[model samples]
Every structure is written in structure tokens, then in C-alpha cells.
Target: MTTDRQISDQRVALVTGGTSGIGLAIAQRLRDDGLRVAVLDLDREEARAVANDAAFLFVGADLSRRADCRAAVDAVTGAFGRLDVLVNNAGFQHIDPIVDFPEDTWDAMLHVMLTAPFLLSKYAWAHLAASGQGRIVNVASIHAQVASPFKSAYISAKHGLIGLTRTQALEGADAGLTANAICPAYVRTPLVTRQIADQARTRGISEADVEQQVMLEPAAIKRLLDPVDVAALASYVVSPAAWGMTGAVLDLDLGWTAR
Candidate 1:
């Protein structure tokens, strides 16, 4: 029931940090949507351990390294022969007061959260352009639009990512490629679970209080976000119906930004 043209028109998606958590959820969702999914992460074994068998490829590459970013893109295009969607979802967070924030930590956060997306976008541009329906979705944070104490580097890098997303949108418009960002708040992921503990210790609060009084304090909804929720949103955003929705910064913040 398929022709060669239809086969060549098949969509392929590459998700960074796709080994687990939000990244994995997105990859699985895209795969279920009938797209060839490629997961780029740091460890091949870890990637395989959590990767869906339906996924098209698992590439081991550190996003924080520019060479690795290029290589990951190359590997995906090599394996799939084309790239249609890019989910820039690889990231980690470090929480610390500005005065105590380590310079190296800041640099590392920027490298992974901000610079990596740019590098990946750069390398994937040509292939994405050729797809005629290329989609670039950056997983930014609520901090991209707001400030929180003890998260100087995280907030800064997220803000920069938003800027990059907007610029990509402008540049990719002529090429049928679209760029957008999803800004989530307090998602229940390994990175956020670790932050819950770190923030508790730093603020001298119980972990429960940290989640209640601090993490969900600004939101209308008081619960942490589910990875599947974000993944669902990602699916919609990258679909053909969302072609008109480029350059938008969508908030999955449980009304945190509404306040």
C-alpha cells in the first residue's frame, strides 16, 4: 500500500537526550505517530536500555560538545537519509545562589542547554530544509521568561534558548522550516527531582515544602508536570497542522505565567 515517493516522504525525528524522562517520552510519542525516531544521548547502553525498539536509531553523542552535535546530526541523516523534525530536549540544571554559583557550572549549563541546540540546529538545517516540513522544537523552561533565585545559570541559558528559537524561526521561514519553543515549569523529570532535593537543602526546607511552597507556588495548578503531557504537546506542535504555528513560545507551565 506504499509507493517509493511516499516512502521517501516519510518523516524522521531526532530527539536529543532521548534516553529517558521527557526526551524518551517525546521520542516514543513520535515513533508511535509513525515517524522514524532517532535518539541522541551520551551512552549507547543507557540509550538502548530505555529506547523503544521501534525507534529507528540510537546515537551516542554529548550535546555539550559541538563536534558531537554535528556527528549526531550526521548519523541521523546517514541512517534515515533525511531529517524532518528536531527536538532539542537535552538539558540539565544546576541551582545555586549567584554568589556561590560556580563559573564552570554556568559554562556547562550554557554549553548543553543553549549552545548545543544552536549547534544541532546549524548542522541539521540543510537536511531539515530539504524535508519541506521541517520542525525544530526547543524544550526551554519557565525560567526562560521569568527569574528565580538560586538558578542564575539555568534562567540565563533558557532565556538565550528562546532568543535562538525566534531567530531560527525567522531564518527558516523561507525554507519551509519552522522553529518554536516549549517552556515547561517544574516537570517531574530526573533533572527536576534532583532540583527538588538541592533546593530543599539550600533553602533549609523539607522536600515536601520545597515542592509545595516553592516549586508550585507561582502556578494555578499545584502539581508537577507529567512528561507525557509535554510529549503530547510536542507531537501536536511538530505535526503538519502546526505548520502555521512557527516562532511561538508555548508555555506548559500549569498557569505559572498566568499569574
Candidate 2:
């Protein structure tokens, strides 16, 4: 779906984790589409570049902290005077068996992926409604729909994030606000590259085997998704054509969930 108003003039988007990987690709795509962009990331160097060079405002901070999340929202609102789109994309994965998972890491993952989205949305709620085109696209994973072993915390958080997306969509529908989740099976990125190595070690498999057997084996595509594929879906979700959509989970999981 699309909208009549050009994305550039409607309002602003605040994207957490916009410095790299899928986040960076989304930020660049939105900027190219003419929307004002504000990025929240922990990378100081990249933040400086984006702040100075891109069609975006950059705030360098750790999003796992509620205060930091609020600060990033403040920066977005401060820059654009209103927020039209909020993309909750900051996430990391730690692969460890449930019996061996570190307590602190588990806490951090839940806070960053799940809690941060809730806090950012709450902080940006009024501005979104006011925009009359409020949109939220959560970056969930295929694991949100199904699970694998040794990913209890990450899987749980993604599942809960989808639930949050549904609830927000229901509550915001009457007010012209829409919320949805994008679930991608596997996208090639630094994080997934790391996961490959870690999975190899954990499963006593070679990296090639992990890629073939564990990751791509489940997909009909048999190749990692392009970051742009996910970004395009996200851009559409927040557009005016998407006004009627809410409480939806859009999955681009390479048919993994088809099974």
C-alpha cells in the first residue's frame, strides 16, 4: 500500500539501531524516500557521520535504557516537531543453552528488544496520533512465530514483541495509528554472521554446515534475504496506503513458517 502525501513532507521517523545492518539499510531507504529521519544507535563514529552527512539526525546512545529511549524520542521530536513513524529495530542475539544462559544477558536482551519498543512508542504516542498518519513497524524475527532450541530468551522476546504489536494496533486503530510486525527468517548481516560462527561452535558443526543445515535448510529460497527486502516492507507499512492495516504480522521468512 501507499499514500497520496509524499513521505518526505508528512513527518519524521525515529529508527533505533539505524547505524548498521538492516537498520542502516532502512534508514537510508527512508531518507531516499524523502522522510525526515532520526537514528538512535550506539556507534559514535557512524552516528557522527549520519548526523552530519545524511538526511537524518543522529543520537548516539544505548537503547536498552528507558531513559536513553526517551532521549532518542526527544531528539526526533526536537528535530522534526512531530513523529510520523517509529521503527523499533534494535536487537541482538545471544546463543546459549537455557541451562547455561547468563542471567544478565537474558535481562539485557528482553530490555532492549521488548521493553525499548514499548517505552519508545509510549514516549512518541501523542505526536503520532497528532500526525494523523501514525505508523509503527516492529522488526521481529521468524522465531517470533516458531522456536528453535537454545534461544528461549530471544524467541520469547520476539513472540512478546508481536503481541505488543497486535495490542498497539488494536488500541491505536481508531486514532489513525497502525502497528505491525515484520518477521524475516534470516538476513545477512554482521549479527547473523556472528550467529553462524556461534551456532557452529555450539552444535559442533562447521560454519558451512551451519549455513546449509541450520539456516538455509529450512528456507525454500535457500539464500539469505537481502536487507533491502525487509526495508521495503517496513517503508510500505508506515505509508498512507497502509493506513488500513494494523495488528498484522507480515512475515518474509523465506517460507520457513510454511512448514
Candidate 3:
């Protein structure tokens, strides 16, 4: 348990899309690490649920909207008084071939996955820098490095996210802040669960086949990654131990990238 003194001394973290799955896990991990935690999600009812059940503050916002992104950051800083760690983990996936992918869906994906991170980082920059030990951790995908079929919008947005992460790291180098991205493969979260179902439908395969042939085909490790596994990496990225690492991409892809 973090004491009041520890909470006061530790940095506050605001996690976007944090009401459930990987984002929620990351929020819990950081909260357990003694930081004051706030979660931003689009669902107001879900936000209330997280606040009540997890004891973390929750703010409602749609990451696809720039105004909502800015409002989320303002709400967190207002509630916590300072924002020091940012984990840009809000994302959704729409699996469709380039020829059939919807234009609006593509726009939404880019806005949420790429633009929202940039806007959040921009809004949070001054407070993070003022903290004198700011850390930004972006939860990118293995797709960030390697492309996959039928995920045009998702792949493009993730690749762009890594670019944004690098830019943030370079710009913050002299400002007592660091930025990095974590690229993971097939984590067991709602997003991946949805992807599994989508892949099954798209490829005319069973969900089990989606897991075995589609999701695990690239990774040496056959099992899906647990949420805590990714959360542990996020925790490390924002911790003092990672102070020297910036503009780096930490791969937790079960050796998928090594190939």
C-alpha cells in the first residue's frame, strides 16, 4: 500500500482508454506503484465502474476527438494537480482489407491511435516537464514494426505512433523527460479478443484457428500474452529505472520481431 507521503512524492499517471483490458491493467500496476492514477475512457458508465471498483479517478472522453483528448488531460491535471507519467494505451482494431476498409473507420483509427497520442502528449508536456522526471509510454503493436494483412488502418496508425514516440523522445531529451513505445504481439485483451473473432469471420476459420494460425504464426511463443505481462513493461518504462532509455522501442513480441 502506498502511504500518503509516498503518493505525494510519486508522480501521477493518466492512462487513456483505461477502463478495461490492457489499459486497466496498466492503471492498476501504476497505482500499485504508489502513483496517483486517472483513467480516461469514452464510456461514462464504465468510467464510473472503474472508479468505484478500482479506486482510481476516471474521466470520460473519446480519444478520436482532439477536443476530448485535450479535455481528458486537463481533467487529470486538475484532479491530480500534476501529471508526470503518460501511458498512451487507448486503441481499437478494425480488420478489413484495404479495398473494403471503410473511410470513416480509417479516419477514426488514425485519430484514436495516432492523433490522440500526439494531442495528449502536447497537452501534458508542460506539466510532465515541470515534474522534472516525466515519462511517456506508448503501447504500440508488433504491427508497428511489421505489417499484417487486412489491417490497413491499424498498421498505418501504429507505425505513425512509433514515429510520434520518437519525435517526443528527441524533443524532450533536454527537458528532464523521456518517451518510448512498447510493441507487443497478440496480448490477451478485449482488443485481441475482438481481433480473434474478426479474423475468424474474415478468414472463414474457427476462433481457435485464429489464435493458432493467424495470431501466433509469427511469434515463437505460442501462448497469448497476459495483460499483466504488458503492464509490467509499461510500469518499467515509466519508472526511474528507465531514465536513460528514450526514443526506444521495447519489443515484447515473443521473439516475433527477431525473425
Candidate 4:
């Protein structure tokens, strides 16, 4: 158990899928913010190679597995003595029409993107509440608010994530925990880069046309956002100043929803 004085002196954070892209950025940002950061990813060796920082703790786990999720929370708290922030940022995209979508793929996507977060939160609840300023930041997408074709699984999972975030917020209010979701437009990550080819194939268009015509068409800004753009927002969401910002679905959508 962590003492109140220890909690106030040093906070710890765990970021899922923290080896690359948005998760890596958020992990780095939290580490820089003076928090002891732990990264949970599927590939332990890959994560160890990417997060080569002495200060950052790296734990590998397949979030799609319930056992892994429980063990992951245990690993973090066991190593750091407490968990103050949880960033559910691990996700992937599969672009295919519903008729052609693989049932297994849908299950796998939901397992990683939606169910994993719930399991992590359930296992980490006590440790988080103990910190007395726990924060849960879900890296949802603009798809949570509106949908795009050929991304049924991703959009559905994101929509469900928001619901989970809200429920967590309500339950954690008295425990001094806050849950919020960050809904951003398309971001420049390996996940989005991979989608270029997938989108081109699904839409029967040139790969060059995917970014402008498919990805950025809905956003008024018409550009992919950097991972750091999200990291900055997440940094704020987990900060001491954001205590009152619970159950908020924050849109860093580049005006995608403005219209």
C-alpha cells in the first residue's frame, strides 16, 4: 500500500500501447511531466527497444487477454507501488465493408480497443482511487461522434469507449478519480499510415488519393494531426489542474465536427 505522503511526492502513470505512435508520445509526455511512467504493450522486446529510458517502466501484455490485463495492472502497481493515471491509448484500424469484414477481426478489434480498457480499469480501480487524484484518459477518435464507412469495428469500439469513460467518471467521482475521452481527427501514426493502403484498396482509389479524399475530407483543416498534438492534450487531461474535467468527450477534431 502507498502512503498519502508517497502519493503526493511521486505520481505514477501507465499508458497502454505505449511503445509507439500516440501511446509513445503520451508516455514520453507524462514522464517529462515528472511522473513515473509505465508502458504496457504486446511486444515486450519491442517496447524495451523503443522506450530505452531508465525512468520509464515497460511491461508487456496482450491487452486482448483478460488475464494479461489483470496482470498488467498488478505489474504496474507492484513495480511503482501505486498507479495515478491510466491512458487507454492502444488501438488499431481495419478498413473493410461490413459485408466483407471478418468476424474474428471484429472480435479482436473490440477486445483490444474496448474490452481491454475496461479490464484494465477494473483491475486498477483500487490503486487509482487510493492515489486520490486518479485520471483515466481514453484516446477515442472523432469516429466516436460521427462514423465513416469501412470502419465499422473501429467506430463501434470507439463509441463504446466513450460510454465506458462516462460510466467510470460517474463511479469515480467520490473517489477523486476522473475519466474522459479524447476524440481526435485522423492522426499521423503508423496505424493511419497503414490505413492508407487499406483505404485505397477498400475505396478502389489510388493510395495517393486516400489521405486527401478519404482521411482528411471530413476535417475542415484538411491535414493529419501529429501524435504530439494528442500527447499535449493528454498531458493536460491528467494534470492536477484538470480535476474538474471529468466525463468530457474532448474533440481535438480540427473542426471536423464544427459543421
- Give per-candidate clash totals: 0, 2, 0, 0
Q: Which regions of candidate 3 deviate over 4 angstroms?
A: 1-6, 198-206
Alpha-carbon TM-score of each model against the true structure? 0.93, 0.92, 0.94, 0.92
> What tens-digit string does per-residue lDDT give for candidate 1 at 33-59?
888889888877657766646445888
- Give Cα distance to truth, residue 152, candidate 2, Å: 1.4
Q: Which residue window of length 10 is worst by lDDT in model 4? A: 46-55
Clashing pairs in 3: none
lDDT of 3 at 20: 85
Model 1 CA deviation exceeding 4 Å by range: 1-7, 52-56, 197-206
Better of 1 and 4 by TM-score: 1
Q: Between candidates 2 and 3, which one is better according to lDDT?
A: 3
- Local accuracy of candidate 4 as per-residue lDDT tens digits, 12-110: 999998989999999989988889889988766767888676457888888878899999999888987889999999988887899999999999999
Off by over 4 Å in 2: 1-8, 198-206
> Which digits, one per residue and each the tens of the lDDT, describe model 2 over residues 1-259?
5555554355788888887888888888888777888888885885678656775688887877888888888888876678989999999987789999999999999999999999999999998988899999899999999999989889999999999999999888878999999999999888988989988998999988998898998888788888899999988998899898899999999989787
CA-lDDT, candidates in order: 0.89, 0.88, 0.90, 0.91
| Candidate no. 2 TM-score | 0.92
RMSD of 3: 1.8
TM-score of 1: 0.93
